[model samples]
Target: MNLTRTHAHAFDAFDHLATMVAVLRRDGRCVYVNAAFESVLGLPRRALQRGRVFDWFVDPATLKVTFDAVVANEFATARLEALLRRPPGAASTEPLPVHAIVTQIDHGEQVLLELVEIEQQTRQDRETRTLDQARITKELIRNLAHEIKNPLGGIRGAAQLLEMDLESKALREYTQVIIHEADRLQALVDRLLAPHRRPHMVSDVNIHEVLERVRALILAEFPKGLVVQRDYDTSLPEFRGDGEQLIQAVLNIVHNAAQALATRRQDDGDARIVLRTRAARQVTIERQRYRLALELHIEDNGPGVPPEIRDRIFFPLVSGRDGGSGLGLTLAQDFIQQHHGLIECESEPGCTLFKIQIPLP
Candidate 1:
């Protein structure tokens, strides 16, 4: 328990920490940095050790005040917001927004610096908001579907009666149109409420089977230009879930990707969609942590989701492609959520990944 004792194991544990941590001397030189810090900043520990900590901050003026406060013993700890310049070869080139704290770690002789990516926090907030929004959307859709049901039945019946009474074949075409339109609306309404009404039929589900079923369907639809490849962890354990619902949810996502690839590369035969699956340990979905979970990824090599509708794509009736019902993802999200899972999307030109994570029993 002596503070001065050399704890090799404790020091080594810092390298594997999830939080970004750096130890700095009072003169601003970084003495050591954890693996997470290096990974987030894309700067190696040696690189950080060679330079002053302030060199990494985009706004040195603000960081300087906090750095001085902790160094001067005026404050035991100081926190500030700053933009971090992304290192070369990073996924993004833009400066990253982060919450940084400088605190005395060794009686004012050394400072412990912690940097947290704002995006990480923001994403958690968004997930919470998304769950609430999904609940509200389902309620609204159910009410609207019920309201449309009675009138829709009446409209269809009236059209049928009008068609039967008409003598002229050409005039009867108008009544047929009315009936057809009513039927379409009714189908749409049913789709909107389908997830809410369908009972979850839980059973042991082999994820590979579901992926294979969807793959076959995709290949049958776009047999020539597109290829569906499988990347699965065969060791994954079977879990309890609604097999049919899971199939439908995965099918909707893979089908959407196939459709996008086909549309974007009508003449290119190299269009590809990968159905990948893996097991995740200690995963968090919808604010609840699970010891184990199954991760399924639907990735496509096509023009990514349209930027305009990307944020709203999961909302009912919001589609990136023309004539798309946009109910595919909405239903997919709902079905997965029912199983205590989450679906997330990340898209950029030529690469789009839809990740579905569900707890494993």
Candidate 2:
């Protein structure tokens, strides 16, 4: 084949796989569109070809900006993330999150536009907000704990001294009770401030390492019938994070699952815990796009979270388990947020999944 014919064939193959690519003339009319564009936009490829770009889309402001960028040619490429409102009579608006990139083609006579939908970005934003809120709450608790903790020790010591000086048995017993109660309160305060007080030793750590550590700990505690399985992506790159904090976060979730499987463990039945890891792209957290992220899932086969307390599980002092301090999951959430990540849970009978997504720096 001639060189020109070979190049044409190569272009044809490239266009087949490229995401929602289209060619437009200087007049903002669509000259060509790829098969992906037709499939994604739910429009006929022939209908879009030779059609005006603005006529098919609803947003005028978006069209103006996109067209201006293409006309200037100052930017070798430009990207705009916008919702592609479907044409009338379509089943849904669907909020098609298109990422449009303009590049000069056809010897500067036309621009090649590429569009890719990033729907996952919306879910990532929600997770990021949840993480931010958890961080704020943790910081507030840390500050309050510090304020109340110092005075508590002093009060407890004073009560102890009073008990020692009291000669009457009944009076001494009352002072002893005061000291005991103060000590209890001090212990609680310590737990509240634990996450903040602990020094973070950040290093390049593999998420799988942390998950494995959590799995080992849970199994050691409930080894008889509880089964822990690993489903990690070994290819995931090491992330810059505090190993101890990551361990604590994973352990908290795993431990909760183990505890929830108490009945199954007693019956010598299978109470399975799955640790999984995967890579995510174009993840948005706090309304910002993170090019790469790690998703760690801790799923368990146990009686799931109660509906009444599911929404409040991450809140301090909210525990579904009897005599539980309710701080494990809350602290886990705080630690993950500190590492620029979020933890989410989906629970139903016999299946509970806790997913933690952290942005890779």
Candidate 3:
């Protein structure tokens, strides 16, 4: 391919994308490296000009096979999942996981390589699905609550009238029971629909302040046999959010952890929970990229969520414990989603981590 001034000008647009783009010759020498290619790999564009594609790849043999296919015209395009080398530095660097696609350009004389960080892609896909699922779930819950609520009022009224008309106290007991149960169901329905009733009240919120409130509340409740630790990055900046909603979300998670730890085995009596915070860069949430985001983790040392209901833990009316209303986590999820954030859980025996990430302005 001829490198005319016009063609060079055309390549300039690729530099603005978040996905890494590189142009290479049939012999594997890099002809051009986009801004993303260098920024993501933590390498200078000039450094990439010094070596072949083999320099960054983990497995030369496998990469060579992929290159061979593109070179021979056997395959117009090929993909490889490989570990990318980190840039030289004074400290430690680990191999970064990346997904790469190589396509023939200039009719097999040149190749176009596009690379995406696997973790970023995974997060974007997961957030997209979560946002979709949350929408569906919210609609379903609202419809179901409305249906149950209308009938519950009628039942409670009928029970109250029956109690007033009854001369026999023995039969009045049954009427009272009916009225009490109806009221309980009414409350449940109201709780299910509570998050949707209020508009998001956004303001500049300090994440540490929210965590501190939750910490004090939990420690006061579980004054014995429970410990809460804080590991905060004080450098993190405050962002726009609903402070009350964030406080409630963190409180629900920490309260659940404390409840689980209440039943900890006698041998491992030192039950603990940690509230950690950090600032994340180049984060993609709900398919939109943000320059900065907040990562808050509530980790606990308690028996993990039961496998039977683990998948449905966030669903309304689903609970791992007996007699639990199961609305706490559901409400927490709803509140987070309202802020365009995500809540993810990872659990195993003696370890559970709930991560909440919200984009920062």
Candidate 3 per-residue C-alpha lDDT over 1-361 given as tens digits, one digit per residue, 9 for 90 to 100: 6664544577887765678888888889887888888777777877886789988877877888898899999999999898888777814487878998989988788999898889878867866776787678889999999999998999999999989999999999999999989988988898988888877898999999999999999988877778899999998988888999999988988989888887762345698999999987666777777768899999999999999887677888878877888988989998887777889888998999999989888
- Cα lDDT for residue 6, model 1? 40
Better of 1 and 2 by lDDT: 1
Least well predicted 10-residue stretch by lDDT in candidate 1: 2-11
Best by TM-score: 3
TM-score of model number 3: 0.85
Residue 135 Cα positional deviation in candidate 1, in Å, after optimal superposition:
2.8
lDDT of 2 by residue, 113-201 (tens): 77766754445556666666776777788888889988988988898888778899999888888888888888899889887678889
Per-candidate TM-scores read 0.74, 0.70, 0.85
List model 1 lDDT by residue over 69-176, tens digit each: 889989998888889888778899989888898899767888888887898778778888888888898888889899999999999999898888999999999998
Task: Report the lDDT of model 3 for residue 285.
Answer: 72
Candidate 2 or 1, higher TM-score: 1
CA displacement after TM-score superposition, residue 168 of candidate 3 (Å): 1.2
Candidate 2 Cα errors over 4 Å, as ranges: 1-125
